[model samples]
Structure formats: structure tokens, C-alpha cells
Target: MGDNIHLDYKYLSSLFSSVESITFEQYIINQKIEHAKELMVYDEFSLSEIAFKMNYRSVA
Candidate 1:
């Protein structure tokens, strides 16, 4: 994400945390979980498939 915006990663993370009050990694996980919930509503993929698509280490 920083590369796309042409900022150093450390700087970007600092800025993000300052503005959002959450670390960038945690923000990403929240987004992925929200997207997974949306996908579940659509019912197009199984739980394991959603976990895999979200890069989770396990379905649990």
C-alpha cells in the first residue's frame, strides 16, 4: 500500500495509526473480516473458501 502511494512503509504505518488509532495490520484484518461477512451474505463461497481467500491460516 505504501508502495502504491510512494511513501515508505514505516512512515505510512505511522500516519495510519495516528489518524485511525489502529495499526495498519489490524485495519487490514478488520477489512478482510468485513469482506468475508459480505461474501457469506451472498452465499457464493463456503467457509473454508472464504478463509483461504482472506489468507487466514485456518478455517477456525
Candidate 2:
């Protein structure tokens, strides 16, 4: 919640006047997923830890 960069995620839907190819939410999700995959290289990080680190409410 506090650490999220896209804190105004919902409101951003109107800010983007162009770029209809992808929504901001989709972009953020993709970036987070890719980041999680990159973090997989480290042996110390568990899936739960990664989820929490990413500010996710659940590990789904």
C-alpha cells in the first residue's frame, strides 16, 4: 500500500490520453511478474517473501 509506485492506479485510466494498446494496470502487472521472475535467481528468496516484498495481499 504505502510502497506502491502506482498508488493512483485507478485514477490513471483517465490520464492516459493515448496508447490504447495497453492499460496502466496491465503494464504494472507485467513489470511485477517480470521482476518476480528475475528475483528467482537468488537462492534466499521464497515465493511468499517475494509476494510480500512486492506488496501483494496474497501469494496467489
Candidate 3:
């Protein structure tokens, strides 16, 4: 079951790599920030916990 839901990292890598004119790193950062904002609205977890879950070193 878990195996059926997995990230196609290779495909994503190829797609991101082909975007020659895009700021791909910034795109990823923006997406993460948006997700954090959404989670903050829910108020389920503390900011520090959310930042840790998102792999941040600290809740800046």
C-alpha cells in the first residue's frame, strides 16, 4: 500500500532540470512557504514543530 504512493524523484528531477529559464530553487521555496502558511491557519501544531516537520533548522 505504501509503495503505491511514492514520489517519482527521477521524473521530477528531469522536469526541474529541463526548466532552463525558471528559478526552480525559488519555486520550491515558495511552495514550502505556502504549505506552511496553510498549516499555520489550522493551528494544529506549534510553529517550532511545523518547522521541524518541514526540515527547517529553526522556526525563523
Candidate 4:
């Protein structure tokens, strides 16, 4: 999906026009955290593992 989509900053800014209080990257991080919460419900995965799967630089 990343290869197919060119995520330009200006385009992302326009895409998240309704979230005026937050930057696009922050919005994405929030979304990722939400998804991580959903994934966390599955007990087979640890938070550190999920963080890595979500491409976080540090699990802390």
C-alpha cells in the first residue's frame, strides 16, 4: 500500500482537514494506537511485539 500510495505531507494535511487540532502524523499515530488496542485483545501477542509489528521505533 505504501508503494502504491505517495503520501505527500500536503496531501495528508488536506486529507485530515477536519482534525484541525492535530497534525497528520499525530492523527496516524492515534489511529495506530487504536488499532494496537484492538489487537491487544488477543492475548497471544505482547505489547512490545505489537508495537514492533506496528513499526514503532521503541516499544517503550
Candidate 5:
């Protein structure tokens, strides 16, 4: 898993280097949505837990 993370980091760094510019808000939103999906599908954490982890004020 650590090796995978290293590879993923390299890939992301390459992507960022290639892109002329990036929006932090869009990136954060996309990551949060992906994480929310994972939390829902995996059922490893409750909605509130996921929301809190994502820095959301509420599940609503």
C-alpha cells in the first residue's frame, strides 16, 4: 500500500507539472466526493464520521 501511495504521488506530481494551472477548490471537492463514495460503499464509517473527516459541518 505504501508503494502504491508512492506511485500515486509520483503520478499526481507529474499531472500537476503538466497542467498549466489547477483549482484547489475543485480538487478538494472532487476528493471529498470520492471519499464520500468510498465511505458509503465500504460502510466502514457512518455518515457523520465521514462528514467530520471531510471537514463538513453536517451530513445534510
Candidate 6:
């Protein structure tokens, strides 16, 4: 994403952390977790499917 914006990833992450009080990676994980919960509520996918969709290596 930072590459698309022509900024170094480390710099972008630092800026994001300064403004959001959380690391950019953590923010992405939080978003993925929230999306997984929403998908679970809809009952449209299995746990494994959700994990895969969220880019987790495994359902573990």
C-alpha cells in the first residue's frame, strides 16, 4: 500500500502508528478479525474457509 503511494513502508507505518496509536500490521489484523466475525455472523462460510479468506496459513 505504501509502495502505491510512493512512500517507504517503514515511514508509512510510523506515521500510521503516530496517528492511530497502533501499528499498521496490528490494524490490519484487527480489521481481518472483525471481518471474520462478520462472516461468521452471516453463517455463510466454515471456519477453515474464513481463515483462508483472511489469508491465515491455517485454521489453527
The 10-residue segment of model 3 with minimum total lDDT is 1-10
lDDT of 2 by residue, 1-60 (tens): 323664564455645424556776777888999898888777579989999988888889
Off by over 4 Å in 5: 1-22
TM-score-better candidate, 2 vs 3: 3
Candidate 3: where are CA atoms >4 Å away? 1-22
Instruction: Name the candidate that leads on TM-score.
Output: 6
Clashes of each: 0, 0, 0, 0, 0, 0
Measured with C-alpha atoms, the lDDT of residue 1 in candidate 4 is: 24
Lowest lDDT sum, 10 consecutive residues, model 2, at: 1-10
lDDT score of residue 41 within candidate 2: 75
What are the lDDT figures for the candidates, one per model?
0.93, 0.74, 0.79, 0.80, 0.77, 0.94
lDDT of 6 by residue, 1-60 (tens): 787779998898899999999999999989999999999999999999999999999988
Provide the clash count, candidate 2.
Answer: 0
Better of 1 and 4 by lDDT: 1
lDDT of 4 at 14: 71
Q: Model 4, poorest ten-residue lDDT window?
A: 1-10
TM-score of 6: 0.84
lDDT of 1 at 16: 91
Which digits, one per residue and each the tens of the lDDT, describe model 4 over residues 1-60? 234577876766776766677877788889999999888987678888898989998878
TM-score of each: 0.80, 0.61, 0.64, 0.60, 0.57, 0.84
Residue pairs clashing in model 3 are none
Question: On a 0 to 100 scale, what is the lDDT of residue 22 in model 2?
Answer: 76
Model 6 sits at a Cα RMSD from the real structure of 1.3
**Which scores better on TM-score, 4 or 5?**
4
Give per-residue CA lDDT, model 3, range 14-53, as digits (tens): 6676885445676788888999998899999899989988
Question: Each prediction's Cα RMSD?
Answer: 1.7, 5.7, 5.6, 3.9, 6.7, 1.3
Return model 4's CA RMSD, one decimal.
3.9
Task: Give a tens-digit lDDT track for model 1, residues 1-60.
Answer: 778779999999999999999999999889998999998999999999999999998989
